[model samples]
Target: MKRDSCQQRIYAVRRVGLAIDRAARATSKIDKRQAARWATAWGVACGVRQF
Candidate 1:
């Protein structure tokens, strides 16, 4: 089945979050939880609800 726009956007945001998380892990800058929080914040700012 085809996903909706919002789902696609969320998936993109998650991909970004994973990238950030991986980069941070590589550099030991931050943890996965922090990365997830940042992604959630971005999503909320972009008006993506249902979190």
Candidate 2:
């Protein structure tokens, strides 16, 4: 029973870790997309076509 509990704890920790990794990846993707949009807007404002 103790071993099973320990295994459960490990599984929970792994799930939490995976969730954090997924969140970080999602946030990074959003940040990258926002940066791209901002760059495009700035380029347009400056009349530059070489992005």
Candidate 3:
């Protein structure tokens, strides 16, 4: 039981890490429109107006 729980935890962590890695890789390939949207959201969150 303990070993099974440990294995499950490791699997979950690996899945989350892989998702983060994919997101980082995808962000690097973002086009201007997506980048603009991200920038706008970030600016709004930071209380700045993004043109």
Candidate 4:
């Protein structure tokens, strides 16, 4: 008789929501977008799995 092993995979999700004050937060919006872009780029460069 033989035994087999299996691997499990997990994923992380980020949910961004919009608000009514969105019209007054231009700088904040830009900053958030820049951060997200950098993070994804860095992850890809480092071979990080993102969902």
Candidate 5:
């Protein structure tokens, strides 16, 4: 597979993962936006890349 196409697939997967995380947080009675912020901060602190 081409590098560009592989990158696009990785990006799409990250977006979907983030969406699922937010949805799960919402169902748990947490504020979605706040949950997203927390997730991003945690990712950054853990040296993980964010999309």
Candidate 6:
């Protein structure tokens, strides 16, 4: 609930989201699968219960 904490969370999500996006754009199928896994981790880090 603190101001700095909220900003830090936003920054963390942005970093993870960017990595997942880059992975998603890879031409190899393996990369895409890896990206899917990263997405789950990212979701968990962002406090998403279900997606």
Residue pairs of candidate 6 with colliding backbone atoms? none
For residue 17, model 4's alpha carbon misses the true position, in angstroms, by: 22
Comparing candidate 1 with candidate 2, which one achieves the higher TM-score? 1
Q: At residue 26, give the lDDT of candidate 5.
A: 92
Q: Tens-digit lDDT track for model 2 on 1-51?
A: 355755665655555455445555655777656555554554443444354
* Candidate 1: tens digits of C-alpha lDDT, residues 1-51: 998877877776776666566646754445666675666666664465445
**C-alpha lDDT of all candidate models, in order:** 0.64, 0.53, 0.51, 0.39, 0.61, 0.72
Best-to-worst lDDT order:
6, 1, 5, 2, 3, 4
Worst 10 residues of 5 by lDDT: 42-51
TM-score of 4: 0.42
Per-model C-alpha RMSD: 6.0, 18.3, 11.4, 10.1, 6.9, 3.7
Better of 1 and 3 by TM-score: 1
Pairwise lDDT winner, candidates 1 and 4: 1
Off by over 4 Å in 3: 1-3, 27-51
Candidate 1 vs 3: which has more lDDT: 1
1-51 per-residue lDDT for model 6 (tens digits) = 555867776765886787678786889988888877776776666665355
Clashing pairs counted in every model: 0, 0, 0, 0, 0, 0
Q: At residue 27, what lDDT does model 5 achieve?
A: 54
lDDT of 4 at 5: 25
Supply candidate 2's per-residue lDDT for 39: 49
Candidate 6 yields a Cα-based lDDT of 0.72
After the best TM-score superposition of candidate 5, give how far the Cα of residue 46 lies from its true spot, in angstroms.
26
Prediction 5 TM-score vs. true? 0.46
Question: What TM-score does prediction 1 earn?
Answer: 0.49
For candidate 5, give the lDDT.
0.61
- What are the runs in model 4 whose C-alpha is more than 4 Å off? 1-27
